[model samples]
Each structure stands twice: as C-alpha cells, then as structure tokens.
Target: MASFEVKGGNKLNGTIVPQGAKNEALQIISAVLLTAEEVTVSNIPDILDVNLLIELLEDMGVKVSRPSRDTCIFKADAVDADYLASEAFRNKGGKLRGSVMVAGPMLARFKKAFIPKPGGDKIGRRRLDTHIIGFEKLGAQFDYHDEEGFFQLSSPRLKGTFMLLDEPSVTGTANIVMAATLAEGTTTIYNAACEPYVQQLCKMLNSMGARISGIGSNLLTIEGVTALGGTSHRMLPDMIEVGSFIGMAAMTQSEITIKGAGVEHLGVIPDKFRQLGIQLEIRGDDIYIPAQEKYEITTFLDGSVLTVYDHPWPGFTPDLLSIMLVVATQAVGSVLIHQKMFESRLFFVDKLLDMGAQIILCDPHRATVIGLGRKHKLRGITMSSPDIRAGQALLIAALSAEGTSIIQNIEQIDRGYQYIDERLRQLGAEIRRL
Candidate 1:
C-alpha cells in the first residue's frame, strides 16, 4: 500500500530514458514457453508485473536467472505443465490480465493449459472470448469451470487454419500468434492487432525460427514450425511512457528530452498528440518537448468540435486515453474524449474536476474536458488511483498542480511503469514514493 506525495509547481528540466515496454515484456516472456532452449531478454523493466510473471515461470519449472540488472535468461527445457494448476499459479494468474497470454504457448507446447480468470484494471469487461475462440479455431478443445472460473484447454496436436478475431484485442492477437507459431500448418489471422507489443512478439518468434509475415498490418500470416530455437532480443522502449513524458513536459512547462524513443514505431502517437496542440521535435532517436505556457486543442474542419478517441492499431491506443484526458484539462479548448474499449476509464474525471478542471462526465466511456489553459493551475488534493492509466494520469496531474498532492494505491502504477518516481525525480519532478 504505497503512496506518492508530489510537490508541484516545478518545471521538470532534464532527460529521461524510458524503460522497456511492460506489455511487450509480458508477451515476450510468455513466448519463452514456445521453445526449450534458453531465451535471453535484455532491457527488462524491474516492475511488479514482470516480477510476478517471472515467478510464475519459475513455478512452472522454467529455470529463470538474472545475470544483470536489466537482463534475464529463461530456459523452459524441463518446465512442469502441472504448475499451471498450482495455487500459486492460480493466484498470480488471477491477479494480472497478461497471465492469459501464457495459455497459448502452454497449450501449444505442452498440449494443455489451465488458467484462472485473469484480473487487471477494472475499466471494462476484457473478454477472453477472443483468445478462446482463436485457440478453438486452431483445433483446441476448451473445458471451462464456471464455479471455479478456471479454463482448461487441451489439444493433442494443433492444426492451424484461418482465424478471424471478432475484434482486434491486443492480448488475443498475441495469444493466437504464439499458438500458431508452433502449430502443424500455416495460420492466417485476419484483423489481428498490429501494435508494437504484438509486433515485438512476432519479431521474437521470427528470431526463434518462426515464419511470420505481415509484420505491421492487420493480416498476419504465421507458418507453423516444428520447433523454435532460443535467441536473444532487446525489448522496445515504452511508448506509453514516452507519451506520458510528453504530457508531463507540456503540463509543467518543462523542456525534457526522451532518449531511445524509437520514433519510427510511434505509428500514430505524434499526430494524436498534435490534436492537443503539443508539438514534438525529433532528434534522431530522441523526442524533445519544449516548454509551453498555454496549450490549445485543435478543432476539426468546417468549424466543428473534434473528439479524441481510441481505436485499433495505427489508431490511438486505449492505454494512453487517461493521459490524454488529463493533458486535455490544461489545454485551451474543449474536446470530447471517448474511450471505446473500456467503460470505466473515464471515471477518473471526477478527481480532475475536484482539482478545478472543467470536466463533464457524459457517461462511463465518455468525458468532455474544458481546458483551464494555464488560467488556473490545478489545486493539489488527495486522490486514489483506480487503474494503471488513471494512476499515471493522477501522477501527472499532481506534478502540475499548485500545492502538495498525495496519491494512494500506487501498486497500480507500479504494475505498468518501472521506477516511475525515481525517473520523474531525475527529470526534476518533486515526487516521492512512500
């Protein structure tokens, strides 16, 4: 039960190197179960979720060792399939949504997988139907226990075929990708999620000798291989953290540079932030955000109001919607933000309203934010974080407020961002975690 006490009104002026992507690390670690050889992953973030996933892997008899601060070696040569049914596995699996991803590789390599209901941010109903339906299409049979809320998937041999996901669920796409990589035949997944995390999974699979085409598109063609060998791969930078840093720099009128921000991978992030009148300058692989006293939200053509919303890949990511909402509070114009993927994501607007931001909660999924635009600095107050994204949003709001602010329930933030308070503190933010 940690909390963050932030003293605001400080202009953060320095450079920040974003940590490895948490979402990507989750999928990549699960991919280790696809092979028996040792898979070395570098640039691993020291976060709660990653540590929990590592524990889950070790419980499955995968030899996990950390040779360096940001490196880990995983060998699944003698992994115990029964560990998936252990109480430790069930408890940890039920605590994190990313735990569902292990189902594919576990079922693919060991012929069966047992997973409890996964838990994550209670923003909306994150259905596992996509994962189950995708696996079922590949010739796997599922037996679900409703009372226990557990799922058992078994398949003697998986024969890949065509799979059209009902929607572009990120984890669903990753699950199917991991499953199809070792199936008996080629698997074609249409309308797959092509986010960077999914892309990283595909890259890791390819490096391990899995043939996967359509790297950056909705249609993924995976040629199932007999077996995959181990390989070393570095995780990508956390794009969500990059976006958060951008918002922090803008809100606090700071000039900060984000290093190792693979600008090429930021498919729609730059333009999406441009909608909020935030301009970024790119220097090779770095992103520089200059100080801004007043920011304004851009309007649409024909004198109409524009709304910022989340969509599938190449569109804005749903993960950053909370940051967008918080940043919008300081902008000069009005913008309606619609979080289509999650219902309760917009509920955090109440806290912002309490800080003197003009926000109207239309419903669970929508919020209309009227920017005070530097006319009024948000007054610091105590708030509780309801989810990961909301926690980061509250951190940014606290950093930009006029007085001291206390944020409880920092575990949600730790689940995603790595060493967030330390990193922000390095950038001259007065944030302390206790």
Candidate 2:
C-alpha cells in the first residue's frame, strides 16, 4: 500500500553494489532445514519475501541468529512437525511462492511436508506439477485437501530413481534435488535446471556431504547421503539488479558503476543489453556505464527489426525483459520484445504507452517498441506496478521522464530490491517513498 513519488530528469552518478541474489537466497535458506547442525548463510538479502520465509522457519522452532545484517545462522535441531499441519503455515506460506520450496527438505527429513496454495506474480500459469511429480517419482505420496487448499506429502523413506522433467523449472529442480539428497539410492535427473542459483545450491549441499555431480549441466546425478552437516555459503550478487542498473543508467543518461556485480555469473545479460546498443565497460568485477545521448538498436545483416526474447538458462532471462522493454523505448531504433515464458508480463506496456512511448502490444506475450530515440522527452504519468520487474521498469521510466510520476503498489518492488528508494537516492535519484 505504499507509493513512490519520483521527480524525473536526474542524471545519477556514483557506485552502487548489487544486493545478494534473491532467488538463490530462497533456495538456500529453505535447504537449511535439511540439517540439524548450524548452517550459516552470508550475503542474505534483507527483503520482505526472505524475511517472511525466515520468520516462518523460526515459528517452526528453528533456532535463528543473525550475526550481521546480511548473515544468518540456522540450526534446526528441534522443529515442530505438528505445526506443519496447522493453519498458520497455510496462511503464511500462501503469501510467497518461495514458501513452497520448504516442502522438499521437510519431506526429506521429517517424512512429511505440507504447503498451502503458494502465491506469486500473475504473469502466467506457473504450475507445481514439476515439483509434485518429481517428489512422487522419488517415492513420496501426494494428497490434496480440497477444503483446506493445501498439499500434503509424506514418505516413509524416499527411494531415488531416474526421471526426465518436462521442463527445466528452477524451483522444481531445487526441490527435487534437496529431497533426493537423503533418499535411499541414486537419483538421476535429466532436463534439470542448471541456473547459477541451482548450481550454488548443489555446491552448498555437497559441502554438507550430499554427493551430486554435473553441477553446471542440465543433467544431475545425486547419491543420497544418510545426513547432511553444517556448512557456510556466500550468495552471488543479484544479476537481475545489475541488468536493471544498466538499463537505468542508459535511460537516465547516467554515469554509474556497479561494484561486485559478479559479472562472471551474469549469463547473457550484458550481451543482451549490448544488443540494444548500450556501451558497457567491465573493470575487474564491476560494470561501468557511461552517459549516452542516444544509442541505436542493432538489427540483423538483412536489416530485419531486432528481436529480444527470453528462454531457459544460458538464454536471456525473462525477468529482465521488462527493463529491456522500457529501455528500448529510449533507444534510437525499433525492437520486438518477446516474453515467451510469461504470457501476461507484456501487459505492462499499457503503462509505458501512457508515458508517451510508442509501443504496440502484439499479444499476451509479445510487444513491438519503436524507440523515440531521444527525439522527444517522455512525459510522466501515474501508474501502478503489477509485478516485481514491471515495478522496477516503471521506476526507471520515471527517472528518465520529463515530470513527476507517482507509482503505487510498491510492495511488489520491495519484495525483491532492498531499500530501493533509499539506495536510488544515494545515487542522486530524486525518489521518495510515501
């Protein structure tokens, strides 16, 4: 229920550090329940979703301690299994989609897991068939309570096997991997999600004695261990935030440096922005973007209109397409944005169109943006953020527009970014939270 009042036309400067990866934190934090020993996680983002997950763990009697603002130690020596069946978990877990991940580790350890209908962005239909089917493949019995709207999963002892996933669902892969870690035999997963987040989770689990191979590929092999021990892990920097900063600097004509951006792990993000004709200098582990009056989009050799689309890992991420679409509005040439993963993500173009950007919404999943090319400045207008990435896109547009813009429903942005308005203000942006 908060709003951001943004005064446009500010050229931001200075260095900003990317926060810890939010997606990675969700998977790793939930894995902490797999061990009774003290597991310490560093570089944890202080965002609403992460904090809510931590609070849920604490409610189940997991001993939680924070040594620093971005570090936490979890010891799940005495968790209350009965509480899993309570209505509190249903109400709380239903608020965040990441909450569903706890099921795998819980079932792996306690022989039972329950999760309410998880909630998240309405971008498209994100089905849980991958996670549930993977669990069932590994010897877990699944049941649904129609009245309660919660899934109940139980397994006396999980027995590992071979299976091929329908798709490389990231959360689904993490859940299955965690569950198979303590299963009785060997597990081979084909078409598994091999994103950096999933790789880090596997590495972290291996450090605690889980035997997993094929860390960076779509196929993974796991040999279930009797138990996992304590381990310390540091999360990678948020690459999506790094991409957002790149778009922000280009749109606002700012000279900014993003420090410790973990550039090595940012697969396809930099090149995708470069395709939009933005210049980026890589200095050590930092990304430096200089002010530009105009940047032209690149097309194919035959002069076909450039198209930027998203795919699975090692491909352009769908999360950054919103920022990419907004940045394209200010570029010198035209580009078609195809958000193949989420059907409803492109609907946010209506808000951008109201800001004087020339865009054609082709369908539920695609749009064609004709960049104004700095020919005229965009006029700000009131808008509401429908999701996390779109919220950041609106903020970027407001920073580059000609007048003040008021954005409501900022809670979606807060779920991912940490103190976004305050951090932007430090970088010379004229933004205030109300």
Candidate 3:
C-alpha cells in the first residue's frame, strides 16, 4: 500500500546506475538449483520479485548467503523435496512468477516438481503451456490438479528432443534450457527467444559445464551433461530501466547520465528513444541524455506517421513501450505506440489523458499520441499504478507535471525499480514515499 508523493516540474540532474537485470536474475538464480555446488551471482537487483524468488529458494533448503547486497552465494545440494509440497511453499511459490523457473532445475536434478498458479503483473494472458509442453517434450509427465491449482510434473528420466516453440517465450526457453542441460541426449530448440537474458543464461550454463551453442540466435543446441558444476555469474544492467531513464530525462527536461548501462546489450533501445526525438549520447558504458525544451517524432521514410511497436529481441522491447508512450506526450509530433505483446497495457493511458495529454486509445493494443510539444504543461492528479512498466511510466508523467501527484500501488513500482524514489531524489526530484 505504499504510495509516492511526487512533486512535478522538477528538472532532474545527476548520474543514476541501472540495477542488475531483473529478468535475467530470475533465470540465473533458478539455475543455481542445477548443481549442489556453490553458485555465486553478482549484481543482483534488490527488488521484490527477485527477492521473493530468493526467499523461495531459501525455503527449499538452498543454502544462500550474501557477500554483498548485490551478490548471492547459493548451494542447492540439500534442496528439500518435501518443502515443494508444503502449504507454505504453495502459497509463497504461487506469489512469484519466477518460481516456475525452479521447477525446471528441480525436475532436472530431483525428478519431480510442482508449480502453483504463478502471480505477476496482470497485463494480459501469460500462458504456461509453453513451459509445460516443453517439459513434456523432454519426457516429463504433466498433470494439472484443479483442486490444488497446481501443475504436477514428474519423470523417471529426462531425454532431450527437438522442439519448435509456438512462440519465442523468454522464460519458457530458459526453463526448458535448464532442464535439457542435464538430459540424456542432445536437444535442439528452434524459434527460441534469444534475448540477452537467454544468451546470458546460455553463457553461464556453458561455464557450468553444459554444452550450448547459438548464443545470440533463434536456434539453440544443447548437449546434455550428466552433472553441472557451479560457477560465478554477473547480471547485465537492466535494459528496461535504462530505457525508462532515457524517457524520464527527455520528459522532465533534465540532464542525466546513466552509469554502467550495459550499452552494447541494450539492443535498439537507444535508437527507439531517438525515434521519439530524444537525444542521448553513448559514452563507454554510460548513456547521457540532455535537457530539452521540445523534441519531435520521426516519420517513416515514405512520409507515413511514425510507429513504435514491440517485437521479439533485436527489436523494440514491449516493456519500454509504456515509457515511449509517456515520453511522446510532450514531444513535437505524433507517434503510434503498438503494444503487440500485451493488450491491457495501453489502458493506463487514460490516466495521462486526465492530465491533459492528447492520446487516442485506438484499441486495447494501440495508442496514438499527439505530443503537446511543451506548449502546455501537464497538471498533476492522483493515479494508481497498474503494473511495473506502467507504474514507472506514470511516475515519469508525475515527475514532469506542473504540481504534486499522488501515486498509489507503488509496491508494483518497487517490484521492478530499486529504490526509485531515493534515486530520483538524488537527481533533485521531490518525491516522498508514504
């Protein structure tokens, strides 16, 4: 129930470091379950979702210790199978979507796993069929228990096989990859999600003695190893957070530099912001966005209206589409934001409309924003955060407004952004957590 009391029209100026990638942390942390040996992970983001997964691991008898706030040492040698069937585990495991990841490693090493209905941002329908089907393809028997609301999966032995995924799901690919790492034969996954998160997992698994190829492509091949040993891994800086900072700097007319942003791995994020006419400089591993009174959107080469849409990796990320929509509010021209990944994410634009921005919600999947061009400033209003990305988008809107705005459901914001209000305060933002 925490809320952010944000005073608008404050021009932020400072250097902010993006936290470790939350998406990658979930998969990497779960991979620790593959071995009983010590696995050390550095640059872990101190956020709710990631912490919840870590706690779930601790509850399952994984020996975990933190050498630093951002580093975790885990030894899963004594993971308790009984804990997975316990009511406590059911409740807690159900609360985090990432907990499903543990099922893969658990099934791979322990031969049995149970997954409850996973909880996360209610953006749209997130299916687990991909995971279940992939597991089944790897020789696991899957059964759904309606009374307990859990998927019961078990196998005497796992043998790898070829799989063509219906879609390139990031978590699904990670889960299946972790399982296939210890299978009896080789596995080939085509049309797989090859985002940086997946590539990092593959690289880490390779270091752990798993044979994996196609590091950055849709086709991935893995040769099963009998056992995986432990290795140290570091997470990349969150690309979503980096993109959010770019939008915030542009909308608030602030000069801010994001340090250690993992620039090379960002993959089209900076260019997407530039599509909105947000100027940014890539220096070493940092991104510098300067203050601007007004920016304009870029049109297609044939003189059609500009459109920013989400696609698979190497394309614009859906997570940052919300930030792009919010940043487009005060820009000099209009742009179409196509949120193809999720249907309900565009619903949050109604809140921006209340603040006097010109936006046309063409449908559940699309929004057309006619930038005010900074001729009129957005006035503050009370709003509630809907999801992690939308919440951050709303916070950006509130920060660039003309007065104080109260944002409820900031817990959603905390689940993704680490100490966001405190970080913004360092940039001279007048934000209070209540």
List TM-scores for all candidates, in order.
Answer: 0.98, 0.99, 0.99
Instruction: Tell me the tens digit of each residue's lDDT in model 1 across 145-255.
Output: 887788999999999899888998889999999999889999999999999899999999999999999998999999999999999999999899999989888888999
Selected candidate, larger TM-score, 1 vs 2: 2
Model 2: per-residue Cα lDDT over 282-361, one tens digit each: 99999999999888999989999999999889988899999999999999999999999888898888888889999999
RMSD of each: 1.0, 0.7, 0.7
Clash totals in order: 0, 0, 0
Off by over 4 Å in 1: none
The better candidate by lDDT, 1 or 2, is: 2
Q: How far is candidate 2 from the true structure (C-alpha RMSD, Å)?
A: 0.7
Per-candidate Cα lDDT values, in order, are 0.91, 0.95, 0.94
lDDT for 382 in candidate 1 is: 94
- Per-residue error for 367 in candidate 1, Å, reads 0.7
